[model samples]
Target: MTISTTRKLVGVSAAAGLILALAGCGAAPTSNPTGSSGGPTAAASFKPCIVSDSGGFNDHSFNEAALTGMQEAAKQLNVQFRQVTSKSASDYTPNMQALVAGGCTYIVSVGFNLSAATIASAKANPKIDYAIVDDPADANNDGKTDAPNIKPLLFDTAQAAYLGGYAAAAWSDAHGTDKVGTFGGMQIPPVTIYMDGFVDGVNKFNADKHKKVQTFGWNVATQKGSFTGAFQANDTAKQTAQGILNQGTDVILPVGGPIYLSAAAAIRDSSKGTVMLGVDSDFVLADPSVKDIVLVSIMKRIDVAVHDAVMAGASGKFDPTTYIGTLKNGGVGLSPFHDFASKLPAGLTDELKSLQQQIIDGKIVVQSKATPKAATSN
Candidate 1:
């Protein structure tokens, strides 16, 4: 299948409509509410709860996306929901335990850092249904990646980041620069998966166009890259982005939640016409302040996955099947160019579309060690 054909197959218009509808879903409750206003009362017997990582619900990334899903499920399914925010790594277990103690019927833990705690909780409370975002909840502490009561929401983000990288490279090349760069919040698999695919996409662009585009902040061979010590430290993220910009990078991809805000600030303040690429959630939609600087976004569709999982669990069809977001499944993809659409070089958009199709068709393989294999039925 070609790029145009793929778009037609995916029903881009319909997807956009669904996204807009979801955007209008009731905002996530700041704290646990008894029931949604103007919506049906949730059955007291069924409660869906979420535990956010340190990023919190307003991080405008994966954590926020997961919460958004829960909120939407509350509105659509008439299910009561609640959420807990983790202030630090130590809070994972306590927060989860608190939710369990509160009689949460299904608990969803966001982020991989909570894997061990989530696994332990799932094992200890085998009767309660559980789902984890961005990880396979291995209940037995075994290497094999599966658990009967836990659903893993994983995304092949490399597939989408690859497209973002290619577009960034093309944009850089068009502007008479061969410099692009990426940085992460941490070195975890979920974070590095994006950087790995980005670097590879830049390499692919270099090879296909016979141009020498340079990538910074990440080295696939060395398995090393630049990172902010913490996900929520905007000051550190800004400093890192400024340092990278000083090195002459005009296209920057920050593979963290709100850290991209720092990069956006740096780009805006530098007055260098630099652009940014967002991860997990579309920064353009999540934060209007960064819309001008975000050329495109590597969307992970976490909200959709979360909503589907909640619906499944509510309808009594919950299973251990891992939901792997891939290009073929509309699980991950690049967002519309938005303001940057008209600014791209001639044919650059077409080139990106073609590259996406190539990846989907197996003509181009976007691989990362962090890529999670689909779960097998036991």
Candidate 2:
């Protein structure tokens, strides 16, 4: 609808810089982002372009899920779609420019790393519709996104994570374990919310059980934990998992996507009786063998959210505020208790459902911190 840009030096050596410069001048082609309820792009003519983060498409995780959404939108809306993969942050903005220059409409960025690059490009070219997943760009200190043209897709994982924590706690206790742990892709909200809700859920379960169950990694109240620096680095995550095990935590949860897969592998090797919980996607989907041992999963509905966003873009209605994923909204939640279903007391499942409703109904608030009530002096 609007195309705006300031003189930006697209260094001569930048990837396809000359092509992008030309893209800034003319109308880009666009197609329906599959399932676009809004009819058709104004141009009735542009293709959708999406850029992937370093993890690449088919990660069976975030990137893969997002790509599916794009492809779905493309197919449903009767449009063409193309995606660029960036191996590093430097490629972010240039990739945006390249797509814009290529005369593709609606350039979409796949992850938080693309925030700045996407924003820069959005500000410069008002005509190109840009969408980013997981991070909202907040130019003002008010903690809200100031960009009217930029669309951000976000998730409130803490809510579902709490349920996941409860599930994990229940699984561990039923199996005769008491200690657990967690980690994240980074210390940012996109990832940490899972750890926070998870810790809160476990703490509540322990409090109700009146038993001291120790957990490491995420401190719900403080909203912090150890991060693996990046989500794609499996080796570091595996090491982190091993370290958690060394500290005596048997149930480990890591919320950093593929990185947690490595953590799962590490836990499978050296724990006395460790159970690994997954995040983002169902671990059982990744490995059915792990299904037999999976305690629970802190599920994020990235697939649905991304698909919805693409549909919205095609329809021409975009909301830039954070899209928090919750149990009520089905944005995030615990997966069905697959293998562990038979192992849990029947009443336990009812209790968890009741707790989930309490959370949704605002009766129980899972504090983002683990502060066990101090022992009373007898």
**Global CA lDDT computed for model 1:** 0.78
Tens-digit lDDT string for candidate 1 (162-225):
8778888988998847899988887888999999899899988889999899999999888887
Window of ten residues with lowest summed lDDT in model 1: 18-27
Give candidate 1 misplaced runs (Cα > 4 Å).
1-44, 139-143, 376-378
Clash pairs, candidate 1, are: none
Residues 73-117 of candidate 2: C-alpha lDDT, one tens digit per residue = 667677778889887677887888899888876777887788888
Best by lDDT: 1
Off by over 4 Å in 2: 1-43, 221-224, 286-289, 319-322, 366-378
Query: Roughly what TM-score does model 1 have, to 2 decimal places?
Result: 0.88
**Alpha-carbon deviation at 372 in model 1, angstroms:** 1.3
User: For model 2, what is the alpha-carbon lDDT of residue 73?
Assistant: 61
